[model samples]
Target: MASLQGKVISITGAASGIGLATARLAGERGARLALGDIQAEPLQKVVGELKAQGIDVIGTVLNITSNEDVDNWIAATIKHFGRLDGAANIAGVTTKEAKYPHLAEVSNEEWEFVMSINTTGMFYLLRAQLRLMLPGASIVNASSGTGLFGRPGMAPYSASKHAVIGLTKTAAKEYGPKGIRVNAIAPGPIKTPMLARVYGETKEESKPNEESKPKEDLKPMSTIPLARFGESPEVATLVAFLLSDDSSYITGTTRATVTGLLGPPRFWQPASSRKSTYGYLPAGQELEGEAGSPRLGLTPAQKLAAAEARRLSQAQKRAQGQLHRAGIEAQKQERLRKKRVA
Candidate 1:
């Protein structure tokens, strides 16, 4: 919680929810804030609230799903604040893939639209911000428990979230050696406008608010050990840590349990360590868990709860496989410590 005084930070999807909470937290920490979103009125309201409280803030009503808008927001941030220190790549979208989609009936337009905003949009903003980021720069991408887990109605959302993990990992590896830390947050359900839009209408008109909402909340929480949805501010707290020096030693990590959404994806432990749990071993060797966990014909819980860890492990294996087959020699570059230890 070091003072963020004079630190310049940018956030997308800042009009509401996680982005707005983050802006508030960042401002309270003395960080200068540059915020972007497609909703002009709410975006301005947030900026107005911050400015009234005497926090230095600039709001740009820009769609993160647009490359031009991404570039413009970056330019606006530097123009208004004079420098960039960190960013929260939080803007996102969902498609029918995550809600009411038929695998064989998915329209091309719907598929492309979701991928563009949720995946490409994040990459666009990060790239734009990186161009002007100062040393020790950090970036946090907003991911979801859904990305790590598969929901019956949310494939696009899950896929997009999965892609975010991939992007953050690659960026962390590429940038950490240059003193930039990149990470992601895979949040569980939060009762944002987005969630209200989905669940609010599902309840019967006669259902009492207290009883219904609690039941609705518990639906997802049943999967979570904590048994609750996280508040937007909760995720904001961790994003702040990743941006600050407090997390200097960490990178390429996607912290997903902030909302107690689900545990890391289930993995296939080495046979030598198997103790006969659904997927556990005798416990002597390090669990090379999701590194090779396959999704083919998985059980229902396995598909949703441990999917992200499975994807991550698959990606890592692919990388290692390429490195071995190519036979290309490469050296690990140092980022923080200058001297290579013997």
Candidate 2:
């Protein structure tokens, strides 16, 4: 194992996905952890588990969009761990609502939300970490494959991630002389909860073949050169390496962890298939009525409602899945206990 003995690493979005994986690996490699996430229950659960295993850890609920939250998290880390050695700025969000939409169709609200979190939130993380980082400390920010290239309907997300690279590089130069290393990892098609949200949530993944679109071509696996979604641990290992002494000489560079996919694939296949009855109608604009066409296009209000319904549905499914997994875990523990008694 690559040892991180005596190193104290702070991670954002640490309750789940990439952050959770990195925390586990960091524990295995002998590092103390300061984990921050927006999800309180999960954050506490993860921290409790790590503590059970004797891993030094402290977790807090953090809203990365707030400068105050970021600042306090960093302060709490230093207070708990005594000093900070490294950080993984891994908190971010994705979107499917803006998929395949024209740039003009994107709303100011949507644009601002994505940028505020993915871009500005990262800046907050870097700022706070750099303030207290001792010499030789490392910082790894999470960018995306889309950050490297543009994708249709993903303007806001792509732009935000791209900004992450710029921030990473700039900070690397600023801090290199002081012995701090800053870098980014552009991961492609990682099988994360965030990816699930982008691709219509966890329930969509489990739907029968008959229920899903039959003609859908070029799935995420097919788009990637490796023909598979990258696992969380795979990316975590890379993050650990970047945050460890092994990559001490590396800085100011963004590494692509994509499975040989150079850029985004053509998400929209058939040109005719791209056509929809509900076109991109700007807010406050009336929908065009086609008397000859059997249906009038959906109004802007209706479209927003549909999108909200999908979001809520996805959330419900995700919650159910979590509960199901918890039940399974309880059962497994009971079985183990009975075996021990026997």
Candidate 3:
């Protein structure tokens, strides 16, 4: 087992989804946790469970979107944990895609609210964290696959996620020399409460294959290449890795979980290579899963391999171009020699 023993990890949005799942799993691994959430009841529930399982944890009710709240949250972490070694900024929100209301119709209040929680909020928390972060600490910011590739009608969400990538890279560069690693996770469609809000929150409810429903043709699953959504643990596993030493060599990159939607390489044959993929896994398998059951797109080795491949490909392409040009010139010289002989 990877020993997270004695590590002081702080996570925002500890109430649910990836945040809550991360806290639970990290606790099981023996990490001391400073967990924060807006929802006090649920957050306390998590704390209760962790304590029951003999995990060391401290719970705080924090709103990451607020600057003062963010400041206090960090203060509390350092006061309680003595030093901060890891943090995961995983709080976010989502809403349904609507048509009658053009994006321009979105109120500034709404826009700011979304950005406050998704982008600005994370920035505020991260800045506060970097102050107390020890050398070799890690930070992870949450981006989204929707931001990686535009999703129609989610303008606010896309904007926040894109900015998240910018923040992650900037921090990675700034802290790399200091031994702190920063990275971003661009999660695809996960079956969080958020997804239910985004894709299933319309008044246009439907029956399962019953036909005669007006919006029956508007099933969003058809577009998701894997035909299902991911669970919170799918994102949490990657979160844990980024926080752990397993990914010490990895930084400055935005990793994603395109669970139902495969990568660019599998864009065409979504079904062919995808057979090897466990597209979000079925409920039966998930319920009966053992330790480390979920595998996000790339295993740790595959992630390293892909990174090496990208580096090699760039170098190979450059050399190939140079050699090809030299070969063309040599061929021209041979033709000139033959003509002179003629």
Candidate 4:
């Protein structure tokens, strides 16, 4: 692990998912942290948990879309830590609708809402961080795989993420001379709250119920070479590396943690042209057997193993769904109790 000892790092969206994962990992690697989020209760809860683990940390509740909020949070971080060595701009949101609407159907309000947080808010945070950061400081911004390629019915989101890449590259070129580095990470189908929401899964469930299947056409896992969702900690590890000296030579590039989903061969080929056995192979072009016949499908043992893996995965998701429901109920009860006391 790349050590972040004594480094003072600031992170946005630190209340949950990838942001929360990064905060925990950075703290464990000995970094002093300033965490900001729109949710005060969850942010404080996370800060308290980290503090108990002996991590040097502070929490601030602020809307990233507000310039004043973004500026004040950065200023407060510098005041608390004395200096900022690194930052992870991880705050972002998707379209409000459960099903993404076509560009023609999307209203101005929806477009502005996504752009305000994902693009303009990022600009505000980056400007403030750059003003205070010294040479050798590093910053990592969150982009998305959609940023690289257009997704149907996600015009606003795709445009905003593309803007993220544009800003990251521009910042890197301008700041590289001063010894500062800027980069972006484009993640695909990470197992986070955002993904859950995108899949139409409610807070009470990890997977969509039979009646409420996801509105999107793509089956996310089936398209990916990894055949599973990327985990939060996996992306956090990359962010940590970018923040540390380990990635000093790397800047201005958008690194993808997409599990080969965006690899040239897979991405360029049409779905109908591809087949998956042990790996992705062009249709009817797999490895040949000793008799020179194409090996078209998995062996019986391999099929059994695949079946067992899927069964276990479904079981895990069910267990997670139960836990999610329990947590929500607990929160609801707590809120009611507080209301009663007041």
Model 1, span 217-291: residue lDDT tens: 323433344556678888888888888888888888988744323333233322333232212112232322233
Regions of model 1 farther than 4 Å from truth? 96-98, 202-218, 258-342
lDDT by residue for model 2 (98-148), tens: 243457777788788889899999998999999999898999999988788
Number of clashes recorded per candidate: 11, 1, 1, 0
List lDDT for all candidates, in order.
0.71, 0.78, 0.73, 0.82
TM-score of 1: 0.71
TM-score on alpha carbons, each prediction: 0.71, 0.73, 0.70, 0.75
Clashing pairs in 3: 226-260
Error of 1 at 94 (Å): 2.6
Candidate 4 Cα errors over 4 Å, as ranges:
203-217, 259-342
Highest-scoring model, TM-score: 4
Error of 2 at 33 (Å): 0.6
Of the two candidates 3 and 4, the one with more favorable lDDT, higher being better, is 4
- Top-lDDT structure, candidate number: 4
Per-residue CA lDDT of model 3 for 231-252, tens digit only, reads: 8987888888899888889999
User: Which segments of candidate 3 are over 4 A away from where they belong?
Assistant: 96-102, 201-225, 259-342
lDDT, candidate 4, 1-342, per-residue tens = 798999999999899899999999999999999999999999999999999999999999999999999999899999988999999999898775544665787788889999999999999999999999999999999998878875655789989999999999999999999999999999887888887777766555444434324433344454465667889999999999999989999999999886444343343344454333112333333222212225424434434556878999999999999999999999999999999999
When summed lDDT is taken over every stretch of 10 residues in candidate 4, the lowest stretch is 284-293
